[model samples]
Target chain A: MREVPVGEITKVVRDLFIDANINLGEDVLVAFHKALEAEESPTGREILDELLENAKIAKEEGMAICQDTGLAVVFIELGQDVHLVGGDLTEAINEGVRQGYQEGYLRKSACHPFTRKNTGDNTPAIVHLEIVPGDKIKVIAAPKGGGSENMSRVTMLTPAVGMEGAKDFVLQRVRESGANPCPPIIVGVGIGGTFEQAALIAKKALLRPIGSTNPDPELAAMEEDLLRRINNLGIGPMGYGGRITALAVHVNMIPCHIASLPVAVNIQCHAQRHKEKII
Target chain B: MAEAKRIKTPLTDDVVGELHIGDRLLITGVIYTGRDAAHKRLIELIDEGEELPFDIKGQIIYYVGPTPAKPGKPIGSAGPTTSGRMDTYSPKLIERGLKGMIGKGMRSQQVKDAMRKYKAIYLGATGGAAALLAKSIKKAEVIAYEDLGPEAIRRLEVEDFPVTVINDIYGGDLYEEGAAKYRRQ
Candidate 1:
């Protein structure tokens, strides 16, 4: 059995958080460049250009790409064969979040839900842990901002609503959201799971690289179809008139009870910020 | 297509009114920052017939809760937060002479209507570009609600702060208009 020191994990988490905030991921940057080129609307193209310029300024100046540094959401894939050594694992993660937000000058967004008071330090990360095969520990840091998160939705439909209903529901959510979630957004659809699981899967789907295809052929096709329909709604970049309202539509599916077809739509804005590390 | 123009911030009603939905604006001037908590207190003071920490007339209020500034910097990543949350308090401030709002996300119909009636405009700064946005803010000082921490009201001096005109005084909505134009038929 391998023993992993808690401090090591904390250090890694802290570094990853700082790095993710300062640098726009290459995949997201490349996707934005592609959007700029393929965007048919002059306004859309211009919006894309502004976004690119913002990114350049962010990188060059070592500034955050956008002001909403986001809530620290840590997804940990722990190996059954490995045991955490020395101090508490959860506390270590939270401490790391505090240090990272402080040192990096990232915003502390977490607050008491009812009081609406800022926590000062972006602490007590929303951690999702999974025990998987092998001895490798994988950590994915996804700093979720409030704008897109507030727009996320979940519904459990009767099996009879089927795929058509699912499609309509997803499109309707996006259309109703309009430019609020930040146009040219990425739609993450989670289908065929329990109520909460569906929501979680939908959010996890966003972690996928933009413009990448799902391995399943059927899921990939649905992604394409939904992407086409959402953009047709005419919510161009920043909701200014444009052909590229949505950058991509990603779907993740799981088996569900025969009586229910649960669905959740998680919207992610142009600043789809996430980073992962395997230790 | 119209050419993009660079305009100074602390934007006036005249300049804001001239902007359309899709116009890209490089803003400069004196802008203030406040979010939900600060807005509530400001409105409460106004309701109680008390003097505000700062005058609302002709001033642009950015809906933001900035990250704590690092040493030697005036402010941290100070980007816009969601605008919808400020829907309730905004119209009241507009009536008090508030001319502009900088934030992300959509405004309620009531807020949009208020913008039209008051000749104000809602500009959208990139939501997550906090660090980049900080570069534009040359100076910041907490003017009110210091107890609210990051949600405190701050008086700011900005230079070429970037924003897009999401809602205009002429009942024009960039979100609706832009989406309609490029939406696949």
Candidate 2:
């Protein structure tokens, strides 16, 4: 059995949180440049320029790209043969998040839902774990901001609505969201499976880099078609109206029960902060 | 929507009236910061007829919940949050003489009507441009709701803070106007 120390996990999670919050990924930067070339609105182009400049400043200063800093979301894939030693796995993850937010000077945004009380430490990360075949663990950290998360939607469709209905629904969510999710946004679509599973995969779809295509030809075509249609909406950058409204539309689908046709749309801002570590 | 006009805060009816949708701006002077939590608390104070922590007359309240400052910096990444979140409380604040708002995103119809009626304006600062925005805020101090953490109200001194006029006193909206001009369908 491969043994992994919890302290090792803790240190990795802490560093990942800080790094992801500060650096705008290279794929997103390239997408911004491409969007800048395609965008028609002068203001939209200007906004894109400012976004690029902000990314540079954040990196140089070692500051967060956005003030929200976000709620910590960790996706973990653990090997069946691996043995976790030295501490509880979940607590170690939260401890790392606590130290990261405190030392990095990032904002502690998690709060009690009803009472609206601050969690203070930014602890209790939203952790998703999958047991895989190998012995190593792969952890992906994504800090999701409230604005884009607030715009995400999930609805079960009638079997009659079909794929076309799902596409239209995704478009509608983007249209309704407009500038709220911070346009030139990344759209993560989760299709099929049970209702909850659809939502989970929809978020996971965001972890894929901007230009990658789905292995399924049909789904790949859908992603391309959606990207074109969304940008055609003229929502522009930051909703001021332009040719490039969405940076990318990523769709992930699975076979659902015959009775179910569930879909979830998770919108991500241009910041697109996520990092992965494998051990 | 011609050239941008340089404007200082604590705006007046005369200056607010002259601004139009799509006009760019460089706002200078002092502004107050308030977001969801602080807005709720401020509205509560208004309903109770208790005094606000700061004077509301002719003041601009930026909708931001900044990250905590690192050493040697006055404020951390201090960009605008979604202004639509402030919609419910904004009109009431406008009614009480809040002159301008600096944030990103759309506003509710009620908030727009209040801006027109009250001779106020809404300015759009580029969203996600937090680090650059921080460079404009020369100073920041928590002025109220200290326990609210990032949501605490802050009084900020700003210099040449860049923004675009999205909603002007004359019922003009840049989001609608700018988008309509370039929309193909």
- Over A180-244, each residue of candidate 2 has an lDDT whose tens digit, in order, gives 88888999999999989999999999999998878999999999999988887888988887898
For candidate 2 chain A, the 10 contiguous residues with the lowest summed lDDT are: A38-47
Worst 10 residues of 1 chain A by lDDT: A234-243
Docking class of 1: medium
What do the candidate models score in CA lDDT, each in turn? 0.84, 0.91
List residue ranges in candidate 2 displaced over 4 A: B1-3
Error of 1 at B70 (Å): 2.6
**Best-fitting candidate, scored by DockQ:** 2
Candidate 1 global TM-score: 0.95
- Please give the lDDT score for candidate 1: 0.84
Report the TM-score of candidate 2, chain B only.
Answer: 0.97
Q: How far is candidate 1 from the true structure (C-alpha RMSD, Å)?
A: 1.8
- Give candidate 2's error at residue A14 in angstroms: 0.3
Residue B123 in model 2: shift from native, Å?
1.0
